[model samples]
Structure formats: structure tokens, C-alpha cells
Target: MERPIDFSRDRRMLCGICAHQWLVDLEWIDRWEQSREVCPGCGTTCEHENAPRVTVDPDDLALDDDKIAQLAWYHTSTLPDWPTRDFDPAADLTPETRRMMGGSKRVAAWAARQRGKALHVGTYESAIHNMLRRMRDQADHGSQFYLYRVLLMPSVVVREGWLIDPGNFVGDVVLDEVCPPGVDVARYLNYHEDPGGLSLALGRGAVAGVQQVAVPLRDACNNDWVREAVADLDGASDALVPATGRLGRFMRPSSPRAFLGRELGAALAGKLPVNLQDQFASAAAFDEGDNPMRWARRTSCLFDLIVVPLRALAELDRQERRTV
Candidate 1:
């Protein structure tokens, strides 16, 4: 049609993952052909229908000064060449923000205390993943509110205020008939190139493959461990004899459990004597923030730690059994 864009206005890019608006080169649209669109930096393919086309006059609310400062610090640290963080609308922090930033680098200091270290904001891909929080969702659809993760990677987190985008910068969501029916709604993902026109089908194949191996392994670990615990409990007098032997062998395309796979199997095989000893002690041993061992019950951690290993071992064993 009419190029679906307005040439008279300034250009900006709103990353669905980081939610940070970076300036777009107006010359880009002029340079590229009418038939296609792709990210200027990465050869990542963005289809014709997916580019932002509309802009309106700015009626932005009073910007949050502290948030703007952090954005500046992030720019200085991550993408040094990007524009500085000072709000175009204002020269300095709001009076209330001056109180929050404490006349010095309060935001940065506070961030270090909370996160222990400044988050190492690196490549665009990593930034996108850290913000969205959601891994590639395979079965989600038709969600109006897309969660784009904004990781405050800079050494400062504004505790007393929130980022305000009063102007409500507008962009277009490019969707086309070529995209496949089911697409993961993870904002950070710049939808993949699928044959059937499913625009956001990127990395779904890997997610699917992991699930296939993880599912059976997770189930078998839980089942096998529970069987042992129950048998022990039922006959308190007898030593815990597992109702079934270990997951004999599992075959997987890749080793998903390189770090904890063998260790988990060894733990499960050894007798911990009482159910009082958490079956998931192994997972807890490596617990960090969002400790799955603590948050998820012992049954779950046990299952999580054991699944990949058990799946690989079990798969191998199954094929061997078939041979016999």
C-alpha cells in the first residue's frame, strides 16, 4: 500500500522483550525494498507486515526522573553509543526523585546491595531473555497483554518509583497469514522463519524436544522414588527395597543434565534411610535464588533433578530390552 509508514516523523524501535525504545534510522525504510523487513543489526527476518508504522503527538506524563537516570546508566554500560538517559522532557530528576536518588548514586548503590553484583547486561539476545521471564511458551495464544521482561540490568534499581511511559509510544504488531496456527507468545523472540507462515515459531522445535525428554524422565523419577519410599514405609521392619530397579538406560539426542545428571542418579540409588531426608537434597545442595528445591516440594525437586538422567538411561534400557 502506502508503505504503511509515515516519513515525516522521527523513528523509534520498541523491543517487545526489553520494552526499551531505541531510535530507529529513518533511512532504513528508504534503503530496504518494499517486499521485506529485517533487523538492521542481526540478519533476523522480520516480515513485511511486522514493522511499526504509526506515530502520534507526544502527550507524555511527567517522566520519572530516577527511572530515566537508570536508563542512562544502562545505556552508558550496555550500549554506550545509544542516547543518554536524561528525559527529553526534563533536564534533571523530579524534586521527589532527588530525594530518592539521595543527591549522589543512590540507585546504583542500592542495586548492588540487593543483587550482590551489577547484572552483566550483555548481548541483545540475553537482554531480551532476562526481561521476559517466560521461557518459550509452546501452547499459549490470543493473549492481549504480552509480558515483555525489562531487566533492570544497570547497577541501579529505582525502588521509590516506577518507569512512566505516559506518551504511550505506539508500534504495530506484524502478523500475517503465512505464520503457523500455534505460536509461542514470548515477546523477546523475534518470531522464527517457519515454512507454514507461523511468524513466531522460532526455537519452538528445541523447546518441544526438551519437553519430550524431560516429561518421561520427570515422571519416571517421581514414580521410582515414591515406590521405594512407600515400600519402606509399609514395611517399617524391613530395609527399603525399591519396588523396581533403577531406570536402566535412557537415550536422548543431547545431554540435558550434564551438570547434575549422574549425581542425581547416584543420590536416588543410594539409601537415604528415612523419608525425613529430602529426596531432593541434591537440588537443594545447589539452591540459588528462586530455589526450586525450597519453593517446589521435595517430590518435585527430586523429580526435576532426576528426570533428564532417568529419561536418558531409561530410553537406552528400553531399546536394549526390545533387542532381547
Candidate 2:
């Protein structure tokens, strides 16, 4: 005899338009999947069949040990060479030093300002989205991009809380305590926006080492689905006339966030959870300019951080390739 379906168990649901997560019964999920459901927090229609289901409690978005261990994290780089040695934030701050080292000052400065010493990594979609951003922003058509699969140490500690939200500050008080006598608090906060940097600087000891084998740009772009979505986004973007009025700008047809949201949502439709796809789209629409941290936070909160020491990373066979 076949086992009966259990509709009593709680199923977690996340709203893509807003980052709100909630719980429902399996029966409700079954019905919602077939039809449409409205998110309580944002009132947006949640109709995607593959909506993100939180594995943990909705109230506590933290990742447990098992979940962290099971998930695979990704990092992307535009360097001409493969197999990056290490991450260094200090050298990134100096424009002359960055130029001398032949690094993309934009990427370095972004990492230094946002992630600090901790390297910025995310889910496959986020990694590819970042690569696309670099390509569009820098106009570096000749550059090659590579994707690395990151492995974290088993014992690495994962922390919770949004890096940018003041309410979610992770207890580093050095900035508040050491503020200069007359410096404006806003300015000081702006200058020291790198929470990951501060965490690393404070000796938090989180580490993530990439797998030796890297996925080159051609392989990623060659995927039929990715190519089509990118082409659609490019076509849409090119067709739009620059917005001049408040109404036109408010619609944001020209915004990078909107463009990326539409692109990524379409590109990773079945591959990612509906909520995550929505989150990517929503974040792109709502986040300031093209700030990747907004979506990165969404991805990180769902997957949690992976920490692996360089010594702990094992070499993988080049013949093995993971599809995005």
C-alpha cells in the first residue's frame, strides 16, 4: 500500500516581492502551488510553483549545522588567470596599488567597501549576476570570468543578521566607541560600511577556500537557458528610451536592479526556489542602484555562510563539472 500524504506538517513560504517568510500547512501549499496566494507582509501575488521553502523556523532565519554542511557556495572572478591564491582587502584601497597590481579597481574597491576582508560569495545565480554586472558596468568585453565552487570547514561558525540593517548589528562596538570627537556619525558609518571586514578584523576567523577546478565563462554562457535570458534582457534594455520624467524614472525601465531581477528570475527559474527568484527580482527593483549586497544578503540568509580554510580545501578532478 502507498503511504498517505501528510498535509499536517508545516511548510515554510517566502515572498519574493518582499523578503518576508511565513509558515503554512502542506495542504495550503498544495492548493497555493496549483493556484495563486497572496503574501501577508507585502500583499504581492505569490504564484510561482517553485516558491522558496525555508528549511528552518521562519522566525529564526539562521542555518543549523546540517543545512550549512549540505549547501554548496559559489564565488566568481574576472581575473585572466585561474586558481586565485588568496583574498587581500588592504591592497584594494589604494588606487595606485590596484592599478600597479593590474586588478579591477571597481571590484577591489567594492569588496573592500562592502565585504571587507571576508570574500563576497553567493549562490550560483548571484555569482553569475555579479559577473554580468561587472561586464556591463566596466564594459570589459575582452575579460574572461571564472566560477569557483567554495568548500567550508566543518567547524566554521555561521552568524545571523543583516549586515546593513542597524537592528541586526552583530555586536562589534569598536566603531561607536572609537568615533573621533567631532566626526559626523553618518559619515563615519558610511566610511566603515564593511561589516565583513570588521568581523574579520576582529578575528572572527571565518574562512572559505575555493575548489581548484574553475568553470570558465564560455561554459556558463553556452548554457542555452542563460543565453536566451541574457539576450532577452539585452534586447529589452536596448529598446527602452532613457527616462526623463519622475513617472518614467519611477517605473525604472533603465535601472540595473530591474534589469538584473528580470534577467536572473528568467534565467534560474526552475533551478532556484521561487521565493529566491522573487527575492533577486525584488532586491534588484528595490536596492539602491546596483548594490549587489542586497541580493547577496538574501542568498546568504537562505544558504548561510560557508567557511573553509585554505589547508582544508581538497583538489577536485578537472573532468568533473557542475552546471549552473
How far is 291's C-alpha from truth in model 2 (Å)?
A: 33
Model 1 collision count? 18
1-324 per-residue lDDT for model 2 (tens digits): 111111133555656556778777644554565656566776555355434433333332113334443355555577522233444545436777666657786655655543322334444444544444454455532345566665454554444322332222432334222222332121111111111111111111232344533323112123344445445444443333466776776764465544564456445433433323433333223223333433333322222211112211233324244321
Candidate 1 local Cα displacement, residue 154, angstroms: 24
- lDDT, residue 212, candidate 1: 12
TM-scores for every predicted model: 0.18, 0.36
Which numbered prediction scores highest in lDDT against the true structure? 2
Q: How far out, in Å, is residue 172 in model 1?
A: 38
TM-score, predicted candidate 2 vs. hidden true structure: 0.36
Native-to-model Cα distance after best TM-score fit, residue 193 in candidate 2, in Å:
19
Off by over 4 Å in 1: 1-105, 112-222, 234-324
Candidate 1 residue-wise lDDT at 278: 33
